[model samples]
Target chain A: MIPGYITTNAPALLIAVPLLGAFLSPLIGKISRDARALWVLAVMTLTALIGYFVAFLVYTEGTLLYVFGATNATLAVPPDSGGIPIRIIFTLDAMSALMVTIAVTVGFAVILYSLTSDARRSGLEAYYTIFLLMIGAILGMVSTGDLFNFFVFLEISSLASAGLVAYKVEKGRAVEAGLKYLLVSTIGGIFFLFAIGILYGQYNALNMAMLADMIQWTPLDKLALVLVVAALAAKCGAVPMHFWTPDAYSMAPSAVTAMLVVASQASLYGLFRICFTLYGITLNYVTIGWVIIILGILSMIIGVTMAIPQKDIKRLMAYHAVSQTGYMLLGVGVGLAVLGDQALLNSYGMTAMEGGIFHIFNHAMYKGLLFLTAGAIIYQVGTSDLNRMGGLGHRMKWTMIFFIIGALAIAGIPPFNGFASKFLIYESVFAFSPLLSIIAMVVSILTLASFVKVFHSVFMGPPLPGNEQVREAPRTMLIGMTILAAIVIISGIFPEFFVQNLITPAAHALTDQAGYISAVLGGA
Target chain B: MRMSKIVRFGADVLFGAIVIFGLYVIMHGHLTPGGGFQGGAVVATGAALVIVAYSYEEVIGMIKKTILMAQESAGLVMFAGVALIAIGLGTTFFFNFLANSGSLFGMTVPFGPNPGELNTGGVLPLMNIAVGIEVWGGLAIVILYMLSGIGKTKEA
Candidate 1:
């Protein structure tokens, strides 16, 4: 049996260890670079372990509620407090556990890749420090059961990631990209705060569970809901609010770009959590669901079409990130559309949600792998422009292989994780509306076309001038890519296994609003 | 460019006073309105005054960037460490294990209104101090770095 202390405190430890490690990284760097690298590795490894352990416990035992600063970890509401949980609580249901798992896994891989890829860069200590802090913030954002706490983590992550985006200050335009990201994020954050104030004025509660129990879909609630959905959609790079996605993703160091994908997904998680759990069936589900679906369609069409004409390799991939986010929104939005109808929901809505959530994992792994490969190319070629690159397939064998795997997975080719999720989404969404499925398929085809162009441009022809001597990526970078590659293949081949274990539980946890409320408030 | 002698003298005189006031705010945070962030910003404003009074080279000598960076990191470490100590003591993370324990900063206050006690509020005071030190260092270093960047721009 797991130690009681560990099982009890795993949620807090999952966030705290990385936060402590971030502050301690700079100090250790004062000792030696190698020491600092090893320190970061140990911290990330421990965080990943705790993350997976909490996920395991949540999957097996059920939703876990950890109340901070309480007499006991499980004491969400004091006996005399009249059913109100005043303290900050972490609600680690299967949905939160899945998000945590993705953040830590990508975090570990990114840090490992950065160890060798960024060894020669200046300001190594600060880079790793901000990296760890971002990881902790993402974990905190997904797990916290308090709206105010979620905002706090959101701001922390925004600041940390903005700093990392500008880490390559000498690289012209990076600082510009970082500034744009910060400005956009700050605006979104203000909107979120405004909505929180509106909700607090109405409900006088910050705990999500309490607020959900009390929400009555008043005018103020409707106003708050609009503000929240807009803010979260902007944060997650949805259409018309995704202006910063290409700039930020293209300019940040590759490892940071990879983790940014997960960061945005955390915002997506917030959007879903609010819609499904906090509001649930109290509001107009069909209207809100249709709104999300329209956003998804816009993102898919615009993201892929824009991606086709991009000359910069990373920028191309970044647009694809926007496109892939649509698939997830499409899948889950379909689920939300039918949420009020139990019979329809039982037939296809759950499958759509499972597909959406599963796609989050698949997208993180494959997209992360793709970004790492692009970084490797930039490392050797010193440019991310497709027009200036060619014929690296012979020299960088492993990077080429990883790129192909990521490319195929993202394009939804069979036997890849992306295909499994997309297939589920297609079949389920088609049942909802045949037109939506067709739009989604067209987007996937465009995604494939763009990647094919990238593959041909970067690795197909004879070696371009001054690139003949380019060698394979370093051992650590290759190993990092290898880890994600292996996951993509395994999950693709065994989609049923992962969907049954991870995605279905997450879908249930998200849909079961009463269960979530009762878990924290103590009774039905 | 350096400021006038009168401005420099005024800054020098007010620096110590500003820092002490900030410390007072930080120390009495649990009982008062101002806490670590506010107090630390107050202290940092004093440092900014010093920076404005002198030139970049002179300010660099007065406040070393490395030391300030270390100070910021140390403060955050301490804050997290104090919270983690609760878990070590068999309570949840951030639990006020010292409150009402009759130890340091552990005196129990009466329920009704009375004169506020300095030796109460358990770990809050400690956290305030930690955050105070951090904000002081963090804000000061940001100003220092900005100045350094300006110096570089001028050279170029």
Candidate 2:
């Protein structure tokens, strides 16, 4: 049974609030622009509060399973159906709860940033509507217990985010890039649905727990697995499949680009969920793990090298986002590779998983901050091209500081959040293969090199002749960046605590498949 | 892009008939194959017929953007609000509190197929109507926005 508090339905309310907000946004916009903005902020903040409350409950009370449309609300298990849950259920485990926290935080910050940025122009109604819908879709994608439900949410998010990416219609290229993003994401969504259909056809179950129990790991199952991995990999921008990342990220408004990073993370989270939980020990772990690792290395090397030559600031960050996603894949890939040995899994593999999971939160913060700062520059200078940027350190001191923190944090420098997670990854991965650790280190140095170039090119030069009137970004944008920058700083200072409190529980939730299965089935 | 007067007159008659049929499909969804989405598509078809019969300028004059948006939003709010009512009733979200409760949309049915009561399926009918309105307004809005886009391109 759920807890006896208002927080009992927080998980459902978390999704409901944003969804209702999205529908109401245009209506409220008709009343007054300021009312519409306040309404959006209020809705987002409410969702965030509910998100944190549910996450805290999950942390303290173990996993929570919520079944929709049940005759008996507390009963997830139907009596006569032999321990099968019939209706739609939302499972709030530690892993999903953590992701929910990241999504809500980033979304709220982005909305705040958008209030004062270039996104505040006309058409604010459609902008906020799609914006909230995109956030709700991400929440749905990360939190749903049904596989088909995840696919549905994934499609919604991809479409909504693509629409948001094209919000800047004044720029012809934004529309073009949005079409490409939409094309690739739609194709990936189709393949993902096909994979879900295969699994459903075989097992006759849409619920993840029931499917996990019924799966036979047959050839068809392996085909389904490959399709899932490929689809999610493409959506999340993994190496060979990552061509759309730069185009979409660079073309979208900066606030939108920040949220897009989190959207891609939701896809990566789906990939991990499918690999570790759905298919778990049923398939060949070694080969699949190698597939992820090779992709990680390629993303790391290719992404960083590609970023170094970029003239556009947002495009550079987009490539680096791909590179940073590599760290997560490599860290978790090492965990997957060593899952065959139980003793190895308990010791090194679990640590590797924690490192990867830790990086998920850290990257969302610093990378989001980086994108927001890029947006701030664009807001001030009317461009994101690095060649045309200079001397913002004088007028926009706060933005400069924030950008430096973001750059330093992402480059894995000491006493930053990136260094802490990358440290865990390097230390744990070395035992699996020293060469992997070495490659990760080289990627880190290259990351530093690229960011230093950005710092010099964007903020360290003399003010250009045409840019004398450039001012600091609006107070709201600075406030938005400050949220992420503060998170990056605090998490960096207390990595051990965050790891113990947040990352460990999430890692346990992922590796503990039997816990998930039993939690649902045992409820009967 | 207007059609001839006879074609426009025929479309005007067809629109009313199609909307009635769509509402029939939506209302009878509890006992039939076609449901809210299908019914909504039917209604949208009616809207498309209207748009096709008139010039883009004439169509813009006839269609109110705010009204369609309100319809869509109101439908969504009704849908979510129905689900939220369960939470207010100390049950789970979308628990169908009206089911077997003898309230609106509440009347228990016997097992197996029989002559269905209009109120037998509980919140399902409500959900169907809500989703039908949402889809109807959503599809119509998409067409209007697209036609407007075309108008802009033609001017440019």
Candidate 3:
């Protein structure tokens, strides 16, 4: 294990470093603009390194616990407590580590992409400050074991991200979208807090492991479960609750939009944490699983159908985000439905979970690249409206290629990461119910068709007369897109390796509640 | 936008008292119910009182934006630095290494409903001050920015 000098404090460092960067960003900005950008980059890179290091340690050494204000990890036990952890606990298992990995990677990519992308905006210092704050809060949200702490981080991220989403001061539309996003997330956060209160009122514990062990599945707990799931699902953009996704995604700066994509995944992480680890087998799996599966199908069908007619490039891509999230919902929902049924689970449930988890990684990479490409086009052409763009591909060849790769991968084409994960979902979900797989396949085709329409409208045809001299994106932006594209390609071609090393372990850790609970409370 | 001279004078007089009360609340945070966030809000109310009485230009002069920004960053850096101290001391991050060590902000005391000693909160008091400073700066700056934004719109 890599539990060396600094590794033991990796959990806290992962959040602390970025938080330091957040305030330091504006300070450094006051001195010099370039210095502030470098500061943000340095901060994100440092936190990403710490994040991956923590993930590595957790992966290798089993779960690593870091308790705040405690002398050591084992000192988390309260003196007169009923085996409940009173201190703030950050429990990093493979699942949380996976989420931390995504947040760090996406955050790093967003920082690099926006280095030059947001040069035109005023208040760059404040922009970087909120961006870093959101990053730190995201890392906090994914890794913390305390429910109320999750709510706190959730609020911080919502505020920070809504601020970023409203970065374009001139674009009144962006601000409007930001306000709506904020209002919706505030309600969701309050609902989530109420759920936490219900749990706390019942068991007098905020720790997930403690609640998992002390659960008497009363009616109030069920109500709490509904509120938590509904709130988190809305936050993550599951179908029927995803109106904010299109508004927020389309209006945000491309860089912030990319990060927002990953942010939703954090909400997904929270949802999965509640479903699998918190409730585990104590909840009614069949009913809840069916509920999730239905939501997944709705998201897949409606998201792609909505994307087909979109003239706005970012809005189109935003709908695609909804569709991609559906695959994950389907994959994980299948796994949830079969919980405690050993024969069915052993046959295909695990693969479904791996597929869902793997898609989180793959979707982040491809969708980020896609958004950056969309941003690049908008940067050069001065609009995100697809009707207003054409033949910039000749000038921006690299961007075109990157966009094509992103489009194809998102369409679930072979030799790309998306195909590998979606294929796994299709192959395994068939075992549970072939109808669901058929619908998924049809949705994949519709997704491909939707992207083709976008590609034709935005990148193909003769150059528009006004944009005769349109140029490729800046060097840093291209480099950022290339980094994500390379990840998409590598994970696509060698997905088995990722599955074996990261996804399978994460899936196992997520499903195995006994191990997760035991990791926190010495065999419970 | 300055209020009448009487109101302005009253605001000026009340600001000092409000700030002093806020400081007391922050200093006794570990012993009392009101901590960093609450005390910072109380302090920010004083800033708001001044902002309400003075014109935008005069308010800018009275509460310099750059200084408030600096104070905010300083508070955050200090808060983070205190936590980072645990990392350097060969303990986990946020570990209360100073507690019960009989050092600065580290005096041990018996747990009870009795009045607690000022020096007995370990790093908690330091954290309170840091957060208090941050919240004060943050809230004042927020009001200033909002008013300035409104000012711009009216002129436009």
| Best candidate, DockQ | 1
By lDDT, who's the top model here? 1
CA lDDT scores, all candidates in order: 0.94, 0.88, 0.89
**Clash pairs detected, candidate 3:** none
Q: How well is each residue in A1-524 modelled by candidate 3, as lDDT tens digits?
A: 55565666788888889998898888888778888888889988999999889998888988878888676754566667667788889988899999898889888888898998998789887898899899899889989988999999999999998999888854498899999999989999999999999999989999888788788779999999999989988988999999999989999999999999988999999999989999999889988988989989999999989998888999999999998999999999999999989889999999999999999999999999999999989988898888889888788899999999999999999899999999999999999999999999999999998888888877789998898889888999998898899999999999989999999999998888988788778765
lDDT value, residue A141 of candidate 2: 88
Write candidate 1's Cα lDDT for A1-524 as tens digits: 77888889999999899999999999999999999999999999999999999998899999998999998999999988887899999998999999999999999999999999889899987899899999999999999999999999999999999999988985569999999999999999999999999999989999999999999999999999999999999989999899999999999999999999999999999999999999999989999999999998999999999999999999999999999999999999999999999999999999999989999999999999999999999999999999999999879989999999999999999889999999999999999999999999999999999999999999998999999999999999999999999999999999999999999999999999999999999885
Determine the C-alpha RMSD for candidate 2 after optimal superposition of all C-alphas.
Answer: 2.0
Better lDDT candidate (1, 2): 1
TM-score of each: 0.99, 0.97, 0.97
Alpha carbon lDDT of residue B132, candidate 1?
96
Cα misplacement distance, residue A186 of candidate 3 (Å): 0.8
The per-residue C-alpha lDDT of model 1 at residue B113 equals 90
* Ten contiguous residues minimizing lDDT sum, candidate 2 chain A: A1-10
lDDT of 2 by residue, A401-503 (tens): 9999999999999788999999999999999899999999999999999999899888887898778789998899999999999999999999999999999
> Would you give me the overall lDDT of model 3?
0.89
Model 2 regions more than 4 Å off: A1-5, B110-115, B149-156
Query: Which candidate ranks first by TM-score, i.e. highest?
Result: 1
Model 1 accuracy (lDDT, Cα): 0.94
